[model samples]
Target: MHLLLVGPPGAGKGTQAKRLAKKYSIPHVATGDIFREAIKNETPLGKKAKEYIDQGKLVPDEVTVGMVEERLSRDDCQKGIILDGFPRSVDQANALSDILQDLELALDAVVNIDVGDEEVINRLSGRRVCSECGASFHVEFNPPQDAGVCDECGGELYQRDDDNPETIKERLVVYSEQTSPLIEYYQERDLLLVIDGETTPEQVFERIEKELDALE
Candidate 1:
């Protein structure tokens, strides 16, 4: 179940990645989580990444790829791993290929969740988070018990800056520019599996599992 999960913003890749990893008994290696852990621990690489991240710029490939390579070498990754939020560009995809070769492993699939830009904007624009507990809620899908309040912790719930309609539109544009070609790159290798992302999470996972089963 060595896989690379790709999707645009608000496509629910994070949720599906966790479910898929559990079903396959593999670690879900999300780069965003890794970056947060590193930044919290203040590792040398984390410090370098923070400089760019705080400035709203992409972290250098050397730092991002180095972190991924180090994570892949860990014990839990020996069996298999589900990669999320990585290889955001063709260069990183190529770097990943080289890294896997060095580790004597091969990727099984590159699963891409396809969703419309308008749906993405609608999904993200309605998203809110708890100020204290960081719990997520969506206006249309999972609204809180009380408006502007966290259901779990009684904290204030507010939309994140990045979840605004304008920000989401900009993010989708950036994602399309950077990730569209990566789709073709994987398709050329016969490893791309594109699935509809607008459906329920369970339905999306079923589609992904069906494809992965075929691969096996």
Candidate 2:
């Protein structure tokens, strides 16, 4: 199905997006992946995106929309796609609707994984990544065998700068301001599937599956 996954930063949208894409046998069209591929291939739009990214500026909505349109127009996406991390605002959502109209595709659902700010802070702040091999661990949910060390590679584990509680709260504030309206935008169109995300990843995916099954 043509799907969009939306949630706050730590709400497990990426995890569920992968599961849904694999289950449905559709492309998982993530915005970050698109930008990386385009820039690696040195496409015109990719070059434009790189210029802005190199300067630490947000790429313009026009460039982002163009990239999404190009991706959705590809042969592989003719079946359907699971979109992640685009349409962060109502304006972008409108642009996406127009793009899909031109491509003669409609979104089957916009899945909103709902997790509270405190839960998000707890989930993200406790995360640790292996400096050597990039293995992920959580202090509470999945702690390493030894503190501050990787079990797989015996590398030092470090927390990302942005994974601190203060940074996470700030991000949640920004997400609330920007995405609350976008959530309503999809809800008004009757294409929203709100799922509780304050559970284990497996449980969250099960909830999402049930919602998608109801849609079918």
Candidate 3:
């Protein structure tokens, strides 16, 4: 079940990763989560990543690669792991190859959740997060019980600045520019699985499971 998920921000990579990892009994490895855990735990790499993350910039590939290298070396990853928010560039992709080589491991597949810019805008624009409970609400699909209020908690809901249109477009640009090469890299290895993301999350997850089952 070892796999990688590559998608733009707000493309629901986290949602899909959660579903797939649970179904397959694989650890979901997200770089952002790892950075936070490392920083909170005061690890050396976490300290280095914090400096970059605080500035709204990416951690350098060397530091990020080292962190992921250490993560993959853990015993829990021996059976399989699901990667999210990683290998954002060709260099990182190559670095991943080296790391997996060192571990004598091979990725089963790389799943790409492809969504259009307009769809992403509509999806993210409607999203609101609870300031207190941290619950997510989508105005269209899953609105809260009260407008501008969290259902689970009586907290005001707010949109993150990064969910704004301009920031989302900029992130899309970065994702395309950086991740396109990794897509080609995996395509060349015959390990790329492209899935349309406009469908419902369950539909998309079914597609992913089917793809992985085929690989098995």
Candidate 4:
């Protein structure tokens, strides 16, 4: 069940990926997690990535591809992996195809969690996070019992700049420009599963499970 989860920023694809990984006994491989682990352990490629990070520049695709290649080569990934936040463009998707061919592994499905623009804006703009405990909440969907406070840790809840409406719109524009073609690229291959993301997380996961089950 080698899988790729794709969605807009507030689409909750990450949550579904985690659940799918746990349920299927696969590693949940996120690009950010891979970079951090590599950098923290000071691998050769990680060192190269760090140099770019120190300069506040995006890590080169070659470096990123190398790291992903290394990760997929690991024993745990031999079973399969749930990939999140990689292959943002057609070029990267092609690189991923190459990497998989080298490893002799094929992707089973690419799940696209589809949420509308206004829905995404509402979901992200209403999001709040605990300052101390890092707990998450939403004003409309999952509000804290006490206003502006964490229910679990008594921490003050704050909105991240990235969650602002303007920032979210900008991100969606960037994502549209970069990822739309990637979606088409996969769709043409008949490996895409499009699921509505405006529903509850449980419902969304259920839909994803159904799709994966169909693949089996």
lDDT of each: 0.92, 0.92, 0.90, 0.95
**Candidate 2 lDDT, tens digit per residue, 141-177?**
9999999999999999999999999999888888989
**RMSD for each of the candidates:** 1.2, 1.7, 1.3, 1.6
Q: What TM-score does each of the candidates earn?
A: 0.95, 0.92, 0.95, 0.93
Over 1-216, each residue of candidate 4 has an lDDT whose tens digit, in order, gives 899999899999788988999999999999999999999999999999999999999899999999999999999998899999998899999999999999899999999999999999999999999999888999999999999999999999999999999999999999999987888999999999999999999999999999899889
Per-residue lDDT for 87-143 in model 1, tens only?
999999999999999999999999999999999999999999999999999999999
* Model 3, CA-based lDDT: 0.90
Q: Write the per-residue lDDT of candidate 3 for residues 134-196, one digit (tens) a residue.
A: 899999988998999999989999999989888888988987888878888999999999999
User: Could you give me the TM-score of model 4 versus the true structure?
Assistant: 0.93
Question: Best candidate, TM-score-wise?
Answer: 1
Quantify how close model 3 is to the true structure by its C-alpha RMSD in Å. 1.3
Which candidate would rank higher by lDDT, 1 or 4?
4
Minimum summed lDDT over a 10-residue window in model 3 is located at: 6-15
List residue ranges in candidate 4 displaced over 4 A: 152-154
With candidate 1 superimposed using the best TM-score fit, by how many Å does residue 211's alpha carbon deviate from the native? 1.2
Better of 1 and 4 by TM-score: 1
